[model samples]
Target: MENAQAVAPKSANSKQNSARRHRFWKQFFTYLYMVILAIIVMYPVLITFITAFKDANVQAFVLDFGGKWTLVNFKNLFTQTLYGSWYLNTMIISVSCMVIQVIVVTLAGYVYSRYRFAGKKFSLMFFIIIQMVPTMAALTAYYVLANMLNALDHYWFLTAIYIGGGIPQNTWLMKGYFDNVPYDLDESAKLDGAGNFKIFWSIVLPLVKPMIAVQALWAFMSPVQDYLMAKFLLTSESHYTVAVGLQTFINNAQNQQVVLFSAGAILVAFPIAALFFYLQRFFVSGLLAGGSKG
Candidate 1:
């Protein structure tokens, strides 16, 4: 019996050692994988930032920061190209789309949430399904329609298209947020002799500002960064967004101004990052709450 107890204790110690070793390896591998993924994800941004500061003599792939660094690329990007105009155009389109989209989506969401309407379920389902469809699938149709309206080169037309593209998803977001708001508020507003429009604009809209911020952020981003639709719709270089303007730097196979491109890319991230940071709280709350309730 003494020998048996001694052997059991030894066995337990061995098992404990094995478990500790197993856990150590497991955590090591998990952290290693995370580090590797972080590296992979950050590699492009790191390279872009590095290259943006590099001189013309430095190769794009050189990881050495001790080499020559110059701000000339960024200076040339503004002076030598239509980058300033492109930036202005992108801001105009993004802001225009954001304003129109927010107002329309807010009205639509309020109506859907507060009123009993025909084909409401079908409409909601259609919004969900249509959002799943890629905009590319209807690219030809949009082009044809733009041609029909003689608006192929018009900036207003492009902004309108951006607004339309953002509507489905934004509407769904607003509707999800509205679903969380209690109907008792609407009832209380009615008891105070408030109409549907008053209730929506004054009370309900204020309550759902988080979702509005989320929608506006998305609406603003789509136009500013969109390359495909902007490229297809706006043929005039003078009217090009920043994305299309950046593409011009690489079109020359013989002399690609990658340094300038990198600088421009770095500049592109500033507005997006700034906006996100500013709206971080509302954006995060809207996303999390909408996901849970929707």
Candidate 2:
């Protein structure tokens, strides 16, 4: 009888251990599935990075896992292209747009959140409806309007487009975030003799720093990545952004020089990737905070 009791308890413990092992394997498979998905997403980026370092012979043919490495492609990128001008032009547009958009969006967000003025609902609805309209649909109007203002090929034009395009969603997003902030803070600031701008600048803006950072980073990357609008808008080669500059590389007689193209792509992707990493921690939190209300 003692042996039977001991054996029964051992059997129960073994069954429990087996169940736990089975659960662990199930979780491991789920994680493995996600890893595979991540690899699929990242494979193209890895290939492009590797291709940038490959020698001319390897670039002309299918990629081999074993290939000669060379800095010739990177050298070609610097010598053969107006990379500096493109870099400068893109930086100007991106930075200018980023600053303008952040300011405009923040102010708009604050107003929409705090005010109960007439037409408030209608104005918000209008912005929402405008957001739903595709940017391409307004291409004709934007082109004609910009031309009328003689703004085409001007660096500031891209800034205008970037800020205007981003405003509706950003306004709503920031406004929603502001709504969740305690109104008592605003009251206390006012009682302490803080002006409207002071309260907004000091108290409110500091609290919404995460969302602002995310928006600015996003704004900075837009014109840098945009090929279509920038292509159509900017007629001068010197005025071309990085996206257009990369296209120019392929458009010229050296169409088959894939390594040079790869090098340029890598350069173009670097800054945006850095910006993404810099703001990555705040991005999701900002959006979630913006969306949630008290």
Candidate 3:
């Protein structure tokens, strides 16, 4: 009996050590993976940052920053280039898209959430199908359509395209979130003699504000980042957005300054970073709300 008790204690200690070793490996691997991913993602941004501070002679990949640093690139962007016009155009387009998309997505989501109608499943299926089709496939068709409508080089044209293309995904996302919200809220509002639009506008809209913030941020960012589509549709340099404006600095005949490109990139990235910092909470809350329950 004394031998058996001693063996049992030894066996327990062995198991405990094995468990600790397993946990240590797991934690170590997780941290290692995170560090690797962070390095991969941040390295490019770090390179861009260094390029922003170096002279025209410095190679972007080199770690050396021995050359003179000047704010000439930024100065040109603000004072000499068409960057101001691009910024203004982008602002108008982004804000318009935000308002229109939110209003439409919220309405569509609320209606899909609260009401039962004919062909509901079919409608959703169609949206999924449309989303599956690549936008690049319809490039020729869209270009033709824009030209026919005389929408070339117009901000409103881009805004419409942004809003239209954005709806399907936003609709699906918002619908899922609205599903998590109890139907009883809608019913209670209706019981107060609130109509569909009223309940949607006053009750449902307010509750799903987090998703709206996320959607608006996305809408604002997409057109700003879009290069190919904007380049094709917007021919004139003066009507360009920041993304297109950045291309001009690269095409300069005298000096192909990587530093200028970097400075422009920094300027572009700052607004997105600032916006995300401000709305980071809403972004997290909104995503969690969709992933889990209401």
Give the top-scoring candidate (TM-score): 1
- Model 2, 46-87: lDDT tens per residue? 787778889866534344557677888888776777777888
What is the C-alpha local distance difference test score of each model? 0.86, 0.83, 0.82
- TM-scores for every candidate against the unseen true structure: 0.90, 0.85, 0.82
Residue 201, candidate 3: Cα error in Å is 2.6
Q: What pairs collide in candidate 3?
A: none
Candidate 2 accuracy as lDDT: 0.83
Q: What is the lDDT of residue 161 in candidate 2?
A: 80
Screening candidate 1 with a backbone cut-off below 3 angstroms (N, C-alpha, C), the clashing residue pairs are none
Clashes of 2: 0
Better of 1 and 2 by TM-score: 1
Model 3: residues >4 Å from true position, as ranges?
A: 1-33, 57-61, 65-69, 251-255, 277-294
lDDT of 2 at 243: 89
RMSD of each: 2.4, 3.1, 3.6
Minimal lDDT window, size 10, model 2: 56-65
